[model samples]
Target chain A: MVNKFSIKNLDMYYGDFQALINVNMEILDKEITALIGPSGCGKSTFLRTLNRMNDLIEGVRVEGEILLDGENIYKDIDVTKLRTRIGMVFQKPNPFPMSVYDNVAYGPRAHGIKKKAELDEIVEKSLRRAAIWDEVKDRIKKNALSLSGGQQQRICIARALAVDPEVLLMDEPTSALDPISTLKVEDLAEELKKDITIIIVTHNMQQAARISDKTAFFLNGELIEFDETDIIFSVPKDKRTEDYITGRFG
Target chain B: MKKKINFKEGLIYGIIGVATLFTIGILVFILGFIFSKGLPHLDSHFLTSQFDSTSAYVDVKLSEGTENPLGLILGEMTLKEKGSIEKQVIVVKDIEKTSLAESAVNNKGQNLAISKNDIINRIEGENVEGKSVDEVNQILNSINADKVTLRITKQGGGIFPMLMTTLMMIGLALLFSVPIGVLAAIYLVEYAKPGRFVNLVRFATESLAGIPSIIYGLFGMILFVMTLNFGYSLLAGALTLSIILLPVIIRQTEESLKAVPDSYREASFGLGANKIYTISRVIIPTAMPGIVVAIILSIGRIVGESAALLLTAGTAAKIPSSLFESGSTLTVKAYTLAKEEANIELASAIGSVIIIIILILNALSKLLSRKITKI
Candidate 1:
């Protein structure tokens, strides 16, 4: 099976300070991969590399190959096309200043979906995939701001899904959400991995254990461990990973 | 025990306190005085028409005499000092002013007239009965018509045109300023790389704001009026006001755009939105109410401006048929009235309308700004 994305000897920088150092990872096709770490860890920075989201930040530079389906995305590939293939949801629930339906349609519209019926179907299907359709379907035309934090987060997830990306990258997607919303996203991630590859950066160890097929641990700008989820939790290869999961150190 | 505030701090605070109170006191006093002196003359004719010069010189004639025609059966007109009587007499015999040449001053300082037509004609109009234009002027020289007693009627200063002029100028000014300034701000905030050039733009905008409005006026008068050949027209005033408002729009819009979290921009980009699309669809909309507020403040500033409009927009008090037509706005009208020492009541009424317009604009801005967070 072809790996959806593979990073080889990647390093990243923000001006003089190094954020990720000599990192290598392969995200398997249609698999749920969880990146677990403490605060200031390079996990989120590493996740941003897959879709080249870090390009938006000023003073950011990345090194080495980020091959998505065998093509180095950092090379001659169109960045816009690259981003369209890999969707992202952020930590905070940032719905656009529009109706909930329009928020979902934002991505599809950007990729050029103008027919109303197509957008409507995409919005419904995507929202259902994100597990927010039943709650928001009645009032999709209302402002997305009127929704609660959890609903908004799910709406953001639905918005990302509407673009039909093959890969979904979540950078601490549940950090700003409440416990119930976090569980809901975890469950949604589980179901989504059947059709699309998902790489989630998370601080919560239990969520990593419950939803992931593979686990990668990062600390101080380095990939500390990468292994099967159960073994990594039960028998981590690195002392740092063991220490972190056991709460002896972070 | 804790010591009380030091004498120096107390003195500093006391000075600030006194200054605040002094400002409040002055505003209260001004408002009271304006409301008192100007309020009584706020009538419908004053609200509806231009100050009639004919109101200044009334003609009274007695039918029994060969001369007096407004039928001066009663002539002495008076009000509490702010009002006085203007008189002229045209003598009509066989329905023609037979003794029109006899209109002159009596020994008692009151105007004695054989005919009102001769007196009325000298002050303003033509068509005096049986008198040549020169003969009418000679009679006016000898008449006891007191120019001092000529009260320009408060009913004459119409608020409609000046009010319309102020609105149109402000509307055009906003139309010119807001789009360009706001787009510039969006570029600076979202797309531009930070460097010496951006710094220069920032400095230039700030400096432009600090440039006196009169300088803007002079530039407009010279450039748009003379060089561009627009003349002292609405377009000239609007363009001048737009320049004056540019810095304000840029600064306010920049601040408001900056207030939107970087995360939103990142999210938009992460969703594969182009820079232009993100700015136009998301950032600008989020920053819209703030831009509107900046526009409203610009409106108030432009409406209250006189010196700027005086040089750029001529004080031609007539209905402007087109953008190129010479026009006088409310501020210009108030200024001309005050300068000529013409009707204060009329001028005060114009000032009151300006205030009302500013208040309405502020309320509208407040209303418009409420949608940003919800948008």
Candidate 2:
């Protein structure tokens, strides 16, 4: 299987604080890869470096290469164009205070798709893909912020999908959700991997085991182990990974 | 300790209540005073007519030879043919015939002219021309019956033109300020890297907000009116007022833009939106309430603006035919009436209108913001 993103010897720094150190990983295409770690373990930072989102923070620096489909993102890719191909869903859903249809259409609109019929089709298809079309179709003209938290999150997912990205990066996408919403999002991730690669950062080990095909465990700014999810859960590679999985210590 | 804390809280609450009452009391007092002074004088005709009682028409007839010679003032007596029974109100202008009266005595020394002041006050209400000798004396002898030499002047002096001028100045000032102020705020908040120069710019804006408006008026008079040769015009006043409004709008817009969460910007950028697109689409719409408040403040300043406009925009109480012509806003008109003419009742009437305008503007802002935000 081809890797969608291959990071080699990656290190990230915030001013004098080194947040990620000598990280190397290969994210396979069309599969759900989960990053699991305790608090302050640099899993979120590692995820951000893949899409160059850390570039927004002042005094932040990155070393080494992250290649998206064989091209170094730092050197060759335009940040805006790169983001379009690798859309992100944040930890807390951030929907623009616009209509539901507009929130879904925002990405395609940003990419210069102006025809109404085409945008309508894109919005419908994206909402369906996000598993929210039936719940919202009647009132797509209503403000997206008026919806429930779970629905808003789904709409945000639809928004990310509208741009037709090949890779979807989710940063603890269900951490803020209730149990039912979390399960729904887990089911969504499982269903979504057939079309596009998904990389998720989650604190719930059970969640990682249930939905992810591959799991990478991070400890103290370092990737301790990367393997099939079952093997990571059942078998042991390193002591810290074993400790983290069994809830012995993190 | 709990009892003591309760006493302190009660004391603070009492202070707050007193302060609120004081503010409300002042507002009620001013409104009551203005209404009492201005309500009786405020009527439709006073509000609708022009500032001056315009002279429309006068009855002048060429007088025959007389010893005083005040009546021989016209070269020709071509009466604008009207039916003897016709009665109509005509707009009277200048009623002078002295120049024509001089040329009437052509080479021969014959009294063929009527003097300019020999106005025949033809009473149109009754047939005084065909009156019997006794009846004519009775009409003249009676103090108020069949009066001759009617100088029928129309009721004049209205505040309508001043209201129009006030509206025009407000429109022009808002046009000049809003776009420039919003753009400047966007640049300062989003684009400019934080440093000493940016700090200096912010400091200058704050300082400008504190300077007295009279200073701004003087500066505007020197720069826009005299230096730029705009003269005492609505354009010059608006331009000056725009400068005064800039610091206010820029500060408000900047604060509103800053209030937009960083997460929104991140989301927009994460979705492939450029900086300009994110600011225009997401940020500005979210910050609209604060911007609207800024605009409302600017309007209040423009409407109540007297000191600045009096110097820059002259107090000519005519409906300006062009932007370059001078005009007076409501505050200026009231000020002129009160200070120069000492017409307190009329000034109070203008004051009442201004208060009503401010209320309408505030209500309009509320309606508009509610419509846009749906909140």
- Superposition-based RMSD of candidate 1 using all C-alpha atoms, in angstroms: 9.5
Tens digits of lDDT, candidate 1, A1-250: 5688888999999999999999988889998999988888988888888888888778999888989889999996788888888889888888887899989998888877899999999999999999999999899999998999889988988988888889999988898988988889888999998889999998888889999999999999999999899999999878889999998866
lDDT of 2 by residue, B1-375 (tens): 999999999999999999999999999999999988987777876677668643222332333343212222122122222254532232222334432333343123443332232222233344343334345334434533221232333445678899889889989999999999999999999988888988998999999999999999999999999999999999999999999999999998898888788878888888888988898899999999879988998898899999999999999989888988899999999999999988888899889988988898888777765755553
Q: Per-residue lDDT of A29-74 in model 2, one digit per residue for the tens?
A: 9999999989999999998887788888888999988999999999
Q: After superposition, how far is residue A42 of candidate 2 from its true place, in Å?
A: 2.0
DockQ, all candidates in order: 0.45, 0.54
Model 1 lDDT vs. the true structure? Answer: 0.78
Interface RMSD of 1: 1.6
Candidate 1 stretches greater than 4 Å from native: B1-18, B51-155, B367-375
- The lowest-lDDT stretch of 10 consecutive residues in candidate 1 chain B is B146-155
lDDT of residue B76 for candidate 2: 17
The candidate that achieves the highest lDDT relative to the unseen native structure: 2
> Residue B209 CA error for candidate 2 (Å)?
1.0
